[model samples]
Target chain A: MKKRATAQEVAQLAGVSKWTVIRAFTPGASITEVSRAKVMAAAEQMNYRPNLLARSLATRSTRQVAVFVDDFANPYKLQLIEATTAALQAEGLVALLVNINEHLDHVHAILNADQRQVDAVVLLGTSFREETLADSRLRDGGPPLFVLARDSQLAGIPAVSCDSAVAMEDICRHLAARGFGRPGFMSGPRTLSTALGRHRHFRDHWASRGIEVAELQASPYSHAAGAAAMRAYLAANPPGARIDVLVCENDILAHGALDVLRHEAGLSVPSDMAVVGFDDAAPSALPGYDLTTYRQPVGRMVETLVDMLSGRRPHDTIVLRGELVLRSSA
Target chain B: MKKRATAQEVAQLAGVSKWTVIRAFTPGASITEVSRAKVMAAAEQMNYRPNLLARSLATRSTRQVAVFVDDFANPYKLQLIEATTAALQAEGLVALLVNINEHLDHVHAILNADQRQVDAVVLLGTSFREETLADSRLRDGGPPLFVLARDSQLAGIPAVSCDSAVAMEDICRHLAARGFGRPGFMSGPRTLSTALGRHRHFRDHWASRGIEVAELQASPYSHAAGAAAMRAYLAANPPGARIDVLVCENDILAHGALDVLRHEAGLSVPSDMAVVGFDDAAPSALPGYDLTTYRQPVGRMVETLVDMLSGRRPHDTIVLRGELVLRSSA
Candidate 1:
């Protein structure tokens, strides 16, 4: 009980060879019922579980999962990893964390390669291009691969994502409720699939709702862009240049808008100009910002991501609802 | 040519089964030279690398490393993971991420049993308690276990840690260079052996340099504690209450001081109050607070942590020298 009760000790008590003790835990592993019962009884007395390294010779799955994330330093990614790791641990699956840069080549390598010790791969979706999924390894035959918040045409590779379509609807409806008719959208780069999907879905939802979008398209997703976009929009439509509500693709952009509203544009959040953002990140909670945001449900999303691989969850596209946290910024 | 080719395809092309292809990659594994050359030639043709799942079968070492973190959402832990994961991946090892919340008993059980298929464990320095290490799986001859900036007595567990002794010296020397006398420390809980070690080392080093610490340990390291300590100290000792320099444990705590300084105490960072923080986090780089701080070499530490695990590194304390990043805060 110092750590592991030796197989020799189990053998000594059960009156059998160490090999017999090893065979008891090996699944689909053949051993006579009498010997198996004796070994199992002895193991139970000692409260022993066989070493996976030795018993894996007789097992099907290794109970290990690989988690891939694009920038570890990004607070948002960190939150995802936090919940995902916890979820994996609860099911007793080892979460193999892989740090990948913004490179599709590495992702393709993961998909095509079956030589890595991981039982499966969990892609923490962030700015993935469609071509990245085109890597042949992801096409059905590869070890069960799951993408977080991304959808792919390939079969069998399941995905767990937030309902971006519903998220957009919530944002638009919130804007209208705030007594703002013309709400502007400042988004991220057009290349990244998340940004693109959000943009298209937001537009389609708004169009169906009968609200004509005033200003749309990509912003740099940085503070400078938020300021520049706000200034440019006002400059062009100076006469009726009044967009009382603004929707940002993410929290950072919304932060920039808040600053621009007070410092540059001489406006305030929830007063002269109402704003909304996605990803209820930590910054939104700070005393200075307190932004009204669509909470990503990071806990549920990451836990569900882990649940999918362990067969505790069905291999399916899961979309969770996001709650809008009404804070001072809105 | 695009990525990795699977062993199954290589075996088919080589006119052999998958087991024969696996034996070719297994070190000192039994296989004929003629068959070996034939398999290698076929693998070369297919551009194949044996995946970790297949490789783990032959070798108990899964090329999977487990990093047990205290909290995932902490930006500091995120930085450590980024560096650690990237470093492990560079050596072709997949990092298994685990969060040990309350159930240390079960967590250790999982690690000892190899439930997640990890080959090694790296405890996050700040989060891991000493008691946790004393009862680790490494003691049971399971797998290589390492800790970051951990205490002594974990014999043979390779550690890559920040030289907090050197960090304190650098912070003290830098503050002295800025013409500040009687610098005070606002550090957190020493529950972590590293945090306690830093506090002890800092006090001794500063005293040796003829600089008496103006402030003793305030409750613990936190935003609330930092602000509370400052307020209490000012109330008690009004004349000598405001020290010219304040060296905080981290950026978060330093931010707490900023709030106290501007709003509560009526002082500015560098002008009226000189503050320095360890861990030059992103907020330190922002416009509102350009904090002069120590940039923990998380990347270097992570690489060393992983390398030590595979016996590619020496079993000794590798101290990383944190740089003093001077900004407007100091």
Candidate 2:
């Protein structure tokens, strides 16, 4: 690679001190308007950019946040990633994407992020065990950690996610109003931190109305898993004794359950069986699957995350409410 | 933040020189077995991680690659991202995600990557004008750039993508063998580097067989755009003059076209109209759609990219062929 232009050369051309040139590039630094203008023009002409990696050594701020993601099968994770990355960029920080999967587990991902000295780490739609975070090496002497679009019961780790309690209440009320007597809850992997809470909310809300609820667990949030779980459920129970309404933890699972119910089980949605899901993914709005689901406040949640990272807001667990979109499926 | 353990502290604990501790952490550094083992134990006891940012200044390599992605609506992009990030991690490199969109354009993203002194840059599914790359500031004194999963006509820039020439031929042959004469190609945005080649391949291949093909352009590569384009095509042409088969640029567009043909246009697939698409996205395999499309070899392409970055392979364009998955749609 060719040598880059130096800041001293730009300062000489702009007829200003080197300190003034540095101040012009630094955010919120004190510098005269005329000096900053001259310095910027000279820097642009010479193609001089301050080396962020080199500057990070002195400031201890790399301005890069490591974002850990594992569940790529769920379409809703893409929306969360886009929103979080854009929000981070708006605050002049870059997102270092760490794909945590079977190859690279959560413990190794956290160590890599800590070694890079990132400003913070954001966990998005991951399915690692809670004991992984309990490692004292990860808990001490590292950058702050935050969770986005998922609930966290761990203390001192602020999480900004949709309020599952409110969403479950809304879904149960809608189902009860429609006079659906038998309800079943379809959940993703049990390792997910948000799974137990969603199941409890759905069951407790239904028990209040004097109705018993059934449950099924699908490992790994994917359409195939959901379809297989639904297939097994249908085979074990006869048509008359089957659950009338099925509540899925996410839209992807709901899509699979709907497909099996219609094509294989020969059941018409909302007539023979009703299905509801959380996370209003884009495909749910299509003409084929007009699913009634809850839309998470992704943009607002990401904004709150950015505010906490930048010290503009206190580090506390925040639960925001979303809208319940009613459609023909439910 | 708590103070990190220093190299001197590890050296004292291990009863060795400080340089020995550094060599134990550095890859490919020469040191005795006993000394290296002793230093590693001491470093692990105190959680001492070498500061990569500080080491980058002396080595002139940050071991980070900037991945530029813009189109999130396409589900195929997520698979490419997962494969690329995992491959990079295997090579002991990190991926710095750069989201290029209306807010952060390609030029700005490139400059940011340049400022950070990343080892290389990879452009993935971006839609930017070719002239934007002609900027001298981006071309000179910057890290090497590569394009993944997209063809690049620009000279000296290596691109690893699926062979459109071969895939189009397979699609055309499949259509002709099925006795389809009136075929139309549904294209995405005109600015895409791969659009013209795909359109040309479809038109020329059909011309060789003495069959003329009709064309329609959809902007933004979204399902809604595909639906709107199909709606306009049907409104313009009568039943007798309508094209019997439609080939979409990607699976997402094909899904929209299929939905419109079935629901609004009141046409049954493969009997009244046939639809085909590329990319073989996850939804394409669902029971509802069952689309016939091409699957890009994302893992192989990412492996080739890593080889190019690590100097194990030459910097040249590589075209890999994928399989043509057949289903009920076509």
Among all candidates shown, the one with the greatest DockQ: 2
C-alpha local distance difference test of each model: 0.68, 0.88
How good is the docking of model 1, by CAPRI class?
A: acceptable
Question: Per-residue lDDT of B270-324 in model 2, one digit per residue for the tens?
Answer: 7888999999998999987899998888889999999999999999999998879
Q: Please give me the DockQ of candidate 1 compared with the native complex.
A: 0.39
Q: In order, what are the TM-scores of chain A for the candidates?
A: 0.78, 0.94
TM-score of each: 0.82, 0.96
Model 1, range A192-211, lDDT digits (tens) per residue?
Answer: 53532666787777688687
Candidate 2, which segments miss by more than 4 Å at Cα? A9-20, A27-42, A193-196, B12-16, B193-196
TM-score of the second chain of model 2 compared to its true counterpart: 0.96
What's the residue-level lDDT of B220 in candidate 1? 45
Best by TM-score: 2
